[model samples]
Every structure is written in C-alpha cells, then in structure tokens.
Target chain A: MKCDFCRETSVIHVRHTDKWFCEEHLVASVEKKVLETVQKTFMINRNDKVLVAASGGKDSTNLLHILHKNFPKVEALFIDEGIKNYRERSKSFIKKFCKKHKITLHTSSFKEEFGTTTDQIVKLDSTKTSPCSKCGVLRRYLINKKALELGADKLVTGHNLDDTCQDILMNIFQFNMEKLARTKSISPGFVQRIKPFRRVSERESMAYSIIKGFESNEGACPYVSESFRSLIREELNDLEFKFHGSKVNLQMIFDRLVPNLEKKVMKNRLNKCENCGGPTSRKVCKTCQILEQLK
Target chain B: MVTLEYPDGAKIKVEIEGSLLKVLVKSGENPEEIIVKKDGKMIAEDYELKKEDVVQIIKVGSKG
Candidate 1:
C-alpha cells in the first residue's frame, strides 16, 4: 500500500488516526508526536538538564533517542535490579547505545545501595507482597536520590499510554486515590518528572525502535508475571482488542481527572525521611520502611 | 474497493459502500475488536466509507 503522504510503500497504519506511513514518515510521525507532547506539557526548559530513566527496553530506548535528539542537555540513568539474566543483558545494550550516542550514562544497583538485590529481597520476603511492589519502591527511591545528586532539572521516564492507563485503572480498581493523585504529571518538591511518550502506545514504541535501528533488549523480567499490574495489563489489552480506541479513551479520561484529583487527594505534606533524608509523605519513607523489613 | 491494513502487515480488500463496520465484517474482523480510522481520524462503526478509502484496522490491545 502507498503511504498517505508520499509514494513510499506504507509500513504502518495507525488506526486511531487513520494514517498510513512508510518508514521515513512513520519515524517522523513518532518523533513529532513526542515533541508535541513535550511542548504541550512544558516539560523542559532551554537550560534544564534532563535525566532519563532508561531500562534498555524499547520504550526507554526510544525515549532516550528522542530526548537526546531534541534536548541539548540529556543524560541517562539505569537501575540495575540485579535480576540475573535480565539486568546484564539490558545493561550491555544500554551501555552500547549510550556510548554510540555520546550520552553520559549513570548506573545504580540495588545490591550496592541497599545491600541486597531484588532477587534476594524477593526470596527473603515473609510478607506475600509481590516482588514488583518492593522493587518499584526501591528503584524510585534510588532514582530520585541519584537525580538530585546529579543536579538534574528534570527527570524523564518512558511511560507510554498503555502503562499510564493501566496504572490509572489499577488504582481505581484498588480504590487508591492517593496513589492515583501521585500519578499527576507534576509534583512540588520533587524533580519535575515528564513522560513525553504518555500519548504513544507500546506497540508504536517498539515499531519506532525497530524502524530507527535501535538495538534494544526486549527480554521480560522473570518476576513480571507476579504483579497485579500484569493482570491489569492483560485485561486492558483484551478490552482494547474488543473495543478499539479503548486504551486511548481511558488515558484521555485520566488526563482530565488527574488535576482535580491531585487537588482533592494529594494533600499529604512532603516529609523528610529520617533514615535516607529523602522527601516522603510519611515520616519514614516507603523505601526506608521496606529496607527495615528486608533487614 | 477499500483496503484494510492490520497490525501484522496483513491487508484485506473489501468491496463495501456502507459504514466502516460493514467493511470490517467483510474483511473477517470482529467489529467489536477492531478500531477503524480514515485520514488519521478515528471513525465510528457507522462512519461511511467511500471508494479508495484506506481504512486502518487496529486491534485494541497493547503489551505493557
């Protein structure tokens, strides 16, 4: 089939927009969408240093590439969860990509910072809490600490539309309004976090990565299936398959709801964690609390 | 004839002058499980299709 804009054979058809594009147009379209999101959100300033949290996956890889291409000051931070096969494979890819792009890459590991790997922590857990729950808290804590130390003006993540929408649905299903409020695009007293691909879907990111010739690691973590998120993700996918545009509609509804929800529910003051000296809503941060349990 | 493109690079040709839903059904796609878009705008099931309209049929699902 011919591309909608040019004579090149079309490679992708975006159904939500009814647009067909060849390789060049598809890459341009993806980059254009990300740039539009960043501009619309006022996510970055001219002098700001953007620290991207990359996991060597398609979403983060595409994010790093796009942000580096557009922004003058962009670097990457990778969290080594030490999940055996996954961490090493992803790290190799990240190192190679960053080196090739001439972007400075920072590395932090759970074992080095917390004295235990995610795999170790999961094995030692007495509470039936999913490993993802613990790993997420630790990863966020470490990333925040590292970003501040690096004096970054903003933190960028590769959370695509699917991840954002799934989190929203999960929070609603669990009746966790405070968690939902925290999902707002901005929060005071924290490094301004931006998700430039919040409107882009996962499939699009993978396609973009391939089309752009990015060598990304596509392996899934072994513990991925243990999270409630995995369940929600599957259900959302099923719903979307049955109802086209369902995911995009869900995200649109979330974007409309988050601002008001933040005002109403995100009232918890940021308190300094007594142990780690990081900002948290509680006295001892969730990370500190988890560390205490692991000890 | 309207050409419908799937996610896996598969294309289906259908001859339908009615709504997008009719074309989707003719292409052997479950109308409920597919999203149809023409000219980069999502068209409802009742959206009319003209000759040579390139309808992109995206299955509503993501691996996140």
Candidate 2:
C-alpha cells in the first residue's frame, strides 16, 4: 500500500499511533525520531562531526543517506575485513553511495592496519573460534581509534532492533556480563557509540531500503558461516516474533538495569592491559592478545 | 572505603574522593553492579557523601 504521507512509500504498517505509514513514511518517521533521540540523548551540535560506520549494506547506507540529508556534515568510515566477495561488494556499494551523496569516505583494512583479516587469521590456525569474533574485535578497535583520530564527537552505527535484541540474548546465553552491562539501546564506551536505528526493525530497514532504492548487499558474510552469533540471531528471530515489543521491552529493561550493570561489569575491569596498557578487565587487552595470537 | 569483589574471587578497596563514576572506572570495576551503603542504607553511586564515605562494589552473576 502506498503510504499516505509520502506517495513514494510502498510498504505500510500502523502501530502505536493511529497514523498509517508506507515504506517511505516509515523510513521518514524513523529518521525524524532518530534525530530527536540523538538530540535528546547526546550533546549533538552543528559543529560536532559524526562518523557513520558504513558496511555498504542497506541499513548503513540508508542511515548515512538520511543523516547526511538531515545534518549535512556527516562522513563515513568503511573497514575492509578481507572477506573475499563480501568485502569487495560491500566496499563497492559504499563507494557508490558516498559518491552519490557527496560525502567523504575513509577506508581502512585489517590487512592494512593489522596485516590480516578475519579470513587470514582464522586460516593461520584452525580453532573453534569463528572469524566473526576476530573481525568484530578488530573492527571495533579500529572504528573507535579512527573516530577519535578523525576528531568525531560521535560514532554512529547501523544496528537495528533485531541486532540489538539478538545481542542481548547472546550475551545472556553466554553469561557475558561485561557485554550485557553496556549493550543498551545506545552502547556506552570510551567513545559514544550511538545506534540511531535502535528502534527500527531489520525488516523495516529492508523495506525502507527497497522503497528508497538504496543499494544493499543482502548476502551474509562468508566468514560468518560458523559464527555462533548467527545461530543466536536465528533463535532470537523466533523469540521476537512470538514476543511482541521484544525490542522495546529489552530497551526498557536495559534502561532500568544499565546504571547498576555498568558498575558491576566494570568491577572486574582492570585499569589497563599489562601488555599494551589499553583499557581492559584483563591483564592484556583483547586486541593485543589477538594480535599476539596472530603472530 | 568501598569493598569491591570480582567473579574471579578478587576484592578491592575503593577510596571515593571525586566523582564516584570516575572512581569506579579507575578501580577497574563494573559501573553497573556496584552497591553503595551508608550506615547500612543503600545509596546511589552519583550521590555525594561526606568525609569517609564507605562504598562497596557488588558482584552480580550473568544469567546465561
């Protein structure tokens, strides 16, 4: 159905409010709401530079596009994780999107920064640990470092509600207390990691991508074939369908518990890694350990 | 003085001076599960205390 607000909108759904919305209307709604949330939650000013972490996928691309339209001064950061076809396609999409949007794109690679990608690291030695962990760890380290280097006030991610809830379940299942403590609707860290699309669902993001004709690579990362996170994502999908408002419920739960949880999670945290002197709850930071393991 | 415990069977004594949040972060403690008490009454971390305010960090297990 065509959205009443915008004629270009295709998919329509009504919830919470009496207003019915098509894909365009929903995307616009999310964009507007996201801006309000950012403004309310963070000290975002006109002078503050935002670094949007782009994966060349629908969600990130659409987010960057919408954000650039709203804020007019946002740039993008793309990390090449060295997953054969996946990285290539994602990079291409990101480049095209940036070119179209006239936004500056900064590119970094695991191979360039760390002399390895998740693929190369996993191949160096066979272990039960999937490449996703390495990629995530490395990507996170680089993202924060790069954001700080670029002098960005905030690092925006494209994590939707589905991903957030799935992560909450994963942390719960694994008893990863440290991860759980900070996995709010908006994550907290040395650098502020904001998920403006936290309230938007994966399906809705997909619909928005389709309606907006935004470029997207819908394929799964090749290295994630053995990822436990993917398994948890599948399980969470069923739970989300059976339990309505799961995202909102989780957000509310986090809101009430985070302040306490943060104190608890960091209780065991060490001042600095003994090896690299980076922040950690252990003697050595995870990145330093991973790098050592790679060697 | 604050008593902080870890899952790995470790304990710490925290001296709350400036910001409780800064102290917690500096002590390598989780900012979420910290329990503060004053004369046996639970207090929020952000609450300012008089001289010699005793604080304790509580360890909470994750429900995996």
Candidate 3:
C-alpha cells in the first residue's frame, strides 16, 4: 500500500482511519497531535513534578518529547507488566529514552509489586480475555500509587484520540453508561489522571514522533496483536473509509448524545466500592476484583 | 452479615465474615456509587470481619 503522505509502497493501514501512512508521516502526525494536546491543557510550572505513564510506544515516546519540549519538570513512570521479552524491551527503551533526555525515570515491576506480570495473569487464566483489562487495572493502580509516591501532582497518560474513540465505542457496545458519561473528561482523585493527548489522533501522534526524530519500539504486544480492540479498530477503519471523517463525525455525535446518554443510560447513582472506596459503579471496584483474582 | 437494601427494595442479607474478597455483583446498579460502611469505618460488603458487624449501604441519588 502506498503511504498517504510519502507515497511509499511500505505503509501501515491504520485500522481506525483506513489510511496508509509511511512510518515517518505516521510518527509526525502523532507528534503534532501530542503537541497540540500538551499545549492546550498542560500548563507546566518550574517546580511542578509531572509523572508521565510511558509505555515505550509511539504515543508515549512522543508524549515524553512534547512534554520535554514545552516543560522542564517532566519525569516518566514506566510500569513493567512482566510480559517477558516484550516488557524487558519496552523497559529498556524507556530507560534509554530517559537517559537521552536526562529526565528522571522511575520503574515499577508487576512481578515485584504484585508477584505477577500481565503475561502470567493471562497464562494462569482460562478465559482468553485480553490482558489489557488486568494490565490496565494494575497500571492504573500503580500509576496513581506511584504518582503519589513520587510526589507528582498529575499523572499523564498517552491516550490519544483513537484511544478515546475506541473507549467510547467499547462503552457504547457494552452499554457501559457510567463510563460513557465520563468519556474524554478528566477528574481528580488522590492523584489526578490527565490525558494531554486525549484530543490527538493515533496517526497524528505517530507523525509527531517521526517529525521529532524519536525512536519507539515497533513491536506490538504478542497478546494485544489480536485483541478485540484491534478488531474494533479494523471495523472502525472500514467505516471511516466508506465515510470520510467518520471519527470526527462520531465525536460530534457522541458530544451531542452524551448529555442525554449520561442521563438516559448512565443516570444510575454512582457508587463507591466497599473495598477501596474508590469510585465504582458496583459494590466492588474493578481494582479490588483484580487484586482478589491475583490473590 | 447485614441485610442492606437498594432503592428498589432489593435487600441483600450479607454476613460480613473474616476476610474480604471483592466481588462485582451483577446488577443494573452503578458499582462506583454503592456505599459500604461498617461501624463508621467504611468497608466493602465482602469485608471479612466479626459476627456483630453493623453494615450500612447507601446509594447515590439526584438532589434535583
């Protein structure tokens, strides 16, 4: 496939947009969006300590770059999910990137903290579910915990527009009304979780990375390569090809519908988990359940 | 174990035991807003405790 920008025969067909992009353009676009996100919402102070959740992927790698470009107080927190070579390599990339930028990077391992990696969790389970669910819960808990541990005020995530859209689509599909209500919105907790790249597209993030000459691991997680998210992405990609600007259109539609959606679909009283007392829609929060499963 | 009620009169007679293993109950209810408290120190319903645990469950509602 010819790249949309470079017209190179070697191109990756992004499943959400159905556009083939050369590696360079892809990285450049991602960087641009990342920059835009950071500029719009993130106001950095000299004394502020920022904790960035880096996954060694393009989105995160570019986020680190943008944060460093505009702010001086950015550090990274990488949670090693204990996925064997996959995690080791990702961790190494983070270490190298941190060293190059001279940013203080802190590392946490699931094996050390929880006695398991996402791979181990998936291996021990028979459900064949995406480890992302477990990894996500662990990652979130640790991110918040570590952010507080490191005395950081805000926890920045590499969630881009496509990620947000996927979540929106997933919530809609699952009838997750409460999650739908807070889609793309930020809230505070013990540690504030913010997405500077929430408005950036995946493709744009990739492009931004290339333009800035940042190196990112091209390897996808072995388990996530065939995950349901990718399948949904492909489905969305097909839709976008049939109707250009579907993502933007979908975002518009969601923006209009979410007010009513929150009322009609998610009007149920919000609950606090009895276990951790965190915000939950059920009696037990998802984090406590995963911890229960691990135990 | 305490018998707590939902707004729809859905009462769950739970026995708070020794150790709490968090369980996500299947319901049309929002999981985040379900309040679990025992003896004025908030706890999950699955919290394993003694025999005489005073548990109260609260639900979020619209003020307007």
Candidate 4:
C-alpha cells in the first residue's frame, strides 16, 4: 500500500485517521504531532531551560532526541533506580547518546539520594508494596530535587498517550478525582513538568526510534508485570486492538471532559513535608514515608 | 514455513498462515504490544500472511 502523503510504500497504517504513512512520512508525522502538542498546549518556550527525563528506553530516548533537535538548551536527567539487569544497561544508551550529541546529562540515584536502591527496596519492602510505587516516589522526588537544582523552567517526561490514558482510566476506576485534578497543578519545589509526547502513542514512538536508527530495547523493568499499571496497560492495549483508536479516543474525551470536571473537585494545597521539606498534601511526603518503611 | 524474526533476535520458524493477530497469539506473543512486518513493510494485526513469508515482529514499549 502507498502512503497517504507520498509515493513510498506505506509502513504504518494509522487506523485512527484511516491514513497510511511510509517510513519518512511516519518519522515526519510523529515529530509533527509532538511539536504540535508542545505548541498547542503551550508546553515549551524557545528560551526556557528544559530538562528531559531520559530513561534511554525507546520512549524517553525518542523524546530526548526530538527535544534536543528543537530546543537550544535541552539537558537530560537519568535517575538510577538501582534495578539489577535494568538501570545499568539503560544508562549506557543514554550516556552514549548524550555524549555523541554533546548534550549535558545529569544523573542521581536512589542510593545516593534516599540511602537505598530499588533492588534493596524490593527486598526490604516487607509490606509487599509494589516496587514501582516505591521506586516511582523516590525517582520523582529526586527528579524534582535535581530539576530545581538545575534551575529548570520545565521538566519534560516521556509520558506518551498510552501512559496518560492508562493513568486517567486508573484514576477513574479508583474514583480518585482529586488525583486526576492534581496532575495539572504545580507544587512548591517541583519544576513544572510537561509531556510533549502525551499526544503520541508508545507504538508511534517505538516506530520513530527504530526508523530514526536509535531505538534501544532495554527490556522491561524487571518488576513491571507485578504492578497494577502493567495490568491496566495490557487491558488498554487490548481494547485499542479491538477498537482502532480506542486509546486516542479515550484521551480525547479525557482532554475534553476530565479537566472541565476537575474544576468542581477541590484542589489540594500541599504543605512542606515535616521530615524532608518536600511538597506533600500531608505532614510527610510519600518519599520520606517509603524510605522510613524500608528502614 | 513462515520465518518469524523477533526483536530479541529469536528466529521462530513455524507453519503459520492467517492474520497477524492470530499468529502472534499462537506464538505466545501479545499482538497488542507488537508490530509485525512482512519484508520490512509494517503489517496490521488483521493483515494476512501466507506460508513462506518472512515476518518480522518488533516488540514495542516493554510491559511487565
């Protein structure tokens, strides 16, 4: 089949638009949509100091590459979660890419920041809480601390459409309306976070990475399957498979309905954590609480 | 036999013919997270394949 735009053979059938794209067009299409997201959402400014969370996984790697191309002062932050067989390998790809492209790369870790690694957290978590939950809290804490230290104006994360949609759906299932509303709020000591790829699907990013010749298959986080998000992701993907553009449609509805409804929900006023001075709705932040539990 | 190539470098050879989704399910690969191609051109889940086809499967974002 030929691409909807050109004469080249179509390499991807975008079922949502019922359009097809060849390799070159696919690359262009993905980049165009991401840039459009940033512009339409007013996510970035030309002179802003942008810090991207680069995991060296396909999505992050692609995000980093695209941001570097568009912005002048884009740097990368990689938080080592201390996962055996995961973090060590993923770092290499980001490190190499950053070096080759001459982009400044900053890194921190759970061990250095919180006195423990994810591997240790998984073993020490007697409560049997999800490692992703623990790791996420700590990683996020470090990202904010580091981003503030770097004086970043905006912190960019590689959250694609699928991830955001899954998060919204999960929040809905939990009846956590406040949490959904909180996603748009900026807290003290946390750099403003942006998701330029929130409109881009994971599959499109994967295809973009490979087609652009920098795709890295660092494998899944070893503990990914155990998390509830994994289950949600699987269910959502299956739904998308059954109904083309289901993920995109859900996101469209969320973009339209959820935020409007969010205004009715009382916004949280976060206070500084007494223990760590981080922003939290409670007296202590989850990061401090999680570290205390591990200890 | 259709020669199936995976991103993990596993070459799977099987007598498979039918939609890509069916083949992925039978091969224990989740169609939801995979992109299939027949000779470098992306194929949809419903796209049909025949015997002797060289199919490449690219695993997308990692799932648990």
Q: Which candidate achieves the best TM-score against the true structure?
A: 4
Off by over 4 Å in 4: B8-30, B37-48
The DockQ of each candidate is: 0.07, 0.01, 0.01, 0.54
Segments in model 1 whose C-alpha atoms lie over 4 Å from true places: B1-64
For model 2, what is the C-alpha lDDT against the true structure? 0.68
Write candidate 3's Cα lDDT for B1-64 as tens digits: 6355543557665544453223214223332324444554434333555545444554421100
lDDT of 4 at A56: 82
How many pairs in model 1 have backbone atoms within 3 A of each other, for residues 3 or more apart or on separate chains, i.e. clashes? 4
Tell me each candidate's TM-score. 0.81, 0.74, 0.68, 0.93
The residue-by-residue lDDT of candidate 1 on A60-98, one tens digit each, is 889999999989999999999879888898899999999
lDDT (CA) per prediction: 0.80, 0.68, 0.65, 0.82
Order of candidate numbers by lDDT, starting with the best: 4, 1, 2, 3
Candidate 4 lDDT by residue in tens digits, A1-295: 6788999766676655667778899899889998999998788999999999988888888888888999998999998989888888888989998999899999988878877788988887788977887888888889989999999999999999889988898888989887787777666778999988887888778778878888464588899888889889888888887788898898887778766776787455778999988888889988889878876
Maximum-DockQ candidate: 4
**Model 1: how far is A75 from its true place, Å?**
0.5
Comparison by TM-score, 3 against 4, better one: 4
Cα RMSD for predicted model 4: 2.2
lDDT of 3 by residue, A1-295 (tens): 5577876643334444556665566666565655665556554455678889998887777778778777768899998877776778778888899999898899988878878778778878766667777787777877777888899976788776667667788877887777788654444454666777766665555445544666676466777764667666656655654565677667768878877766665555557789977766679978788878766
